[model samples]
Target: MRSKTAKLISWTTGGFLLVLAAFRAPAEVTYFLLSTRLVGSALGSCVLPLTKPEDIAEARREMTLDQPPLIPLVRITAGADGINRDYLAPGKPSWTWHVTGFVGFVEGVPEILESTPALVERRQGGWFHDSSGAATVAFTGYKPVAELTREQIFFASAQLTANGMDLHWVDLGANYLYTVETSSSFSPANWMPAPGGSWPIAGTNWVDIATPLSGPRFYRVKAELKSP
Candidate 1:
């Protein structure tokens, strides 16, 4: 009977050992890191008005901005999950962001950061005129501060003045491509710059008419983002 009891105890001990062996520790992969059903998460976030002024300057220079119109930016902080760590895994962490997409018709602005590493390229386009053929100004912008960045830019119609044709606008600033084309008739080829030259205003508006536009003429402002 004692022998029979000893054999039963041995069998029970072996079964317990097999159960322990079946339940091994999980791997480092995040897939199985969480419980069967997830509850809370560790998502990353960020704020605007960047800490680095140089980065802001780079962004402004890329857009060829010489005036202040209150730019907006979306700052991002990488998730501090397993991703934040270096190759060593236990090393200190650094943040990064991947910038892409349109700034209103523009494709993929600056790509600031990436885990594997990348680059930020800003390409400003040339004169974009409306073929619809109406009283409208050409559109060109490189304000990468925020997506869909809107600014009040209008090219007022040339008015007849006592001295000459006075050209002014309600709101316009840092227009590097402020080229005014005037024509006696409504023809593309006939349209040319004012008597002096194309006045590309870098900043400010309301310039006194030096060259008198004596007779009736057509005026259209072409704003183009020069190639950077």
Candidate 2:
């Protein structure tokens, strides 16, 4: 992005420098200016179509109930050469522009996640400038991860991580009455009540416990949400 900016600044300054450098050679100076203009024209032509608000709405409508947590994809390009290309608008974008001039139109500016691009006049391939470009639109799809149930209950299923084992359960209106048990052994004698309190609300909740350093650790959750 900085490179693109530098190239853009060069566009403003390069001509002046060329004049100074070619004072002894007037013919070369004229050639240089002409080359710069041609390259700039090419860079101006490589613009990609911007994403439209209607497009995003249509995309969301096309998704099924099974699809959720849509993610958007934005494209960024440094030049017509297509060598320095990247994406914008992932789970989040670095910058966002809003369109407030028009109502019932694209409601907001597209988010930009790629580096800033600048048109760079290059002598390669017979004098051309790089087309620095950004996308003003986005398309969405189901997020990378599958949709998760907001509420569900499990007996012994727990995910172990470096910090601890995360246990989860859905409070089915059982007044959120619940208890947890953990043990290093499978023997009932080794099982004892794990100290914990009720969740603030009767829904899905989670708890984390330190990972056992020795033998395999086990956990169990029993919950009861009272009927209304």
Give the runs in model 2 whose Cα sits over 4 Å from its true position.
Answer: 1-157, 195-203, 225-228
Best by TM-score: 1
In order of appearance, the predictions have TM-scores of 0.28, 0.27
Stretches > 4 Å off in candidate 1: 1-157, 170-175, 187-189, 203-215
Model 1 Cα lDDT, one tens digit per residue, 1-228 = 010000000011322211000111122211100010112222221112222445545544544444532222222222222122122122222224222211222233343311121111111111112342111111122233321111111213334356555554322212234555555553333765556654654332333355332433445454444445
For residues 1-228, could you state the per-residue lDDT of candidate 2 as single tens digits?
010100000011322211000001112111100011222233211112223556434433433334342333334322332111112213211112211111121223344321122222222222122353333222222121111111110112344455555654422232445455555554543655555544333434455455444455554444444445
TM-score of 1: 0.28
Worst 10 residues of 1 by lDDT: 1-10
The stretch of ten residues in a row with the least summed lDDT in candidate 2 is: 1-10
Total clashing residue pairs per candidate?
A: 0, 10
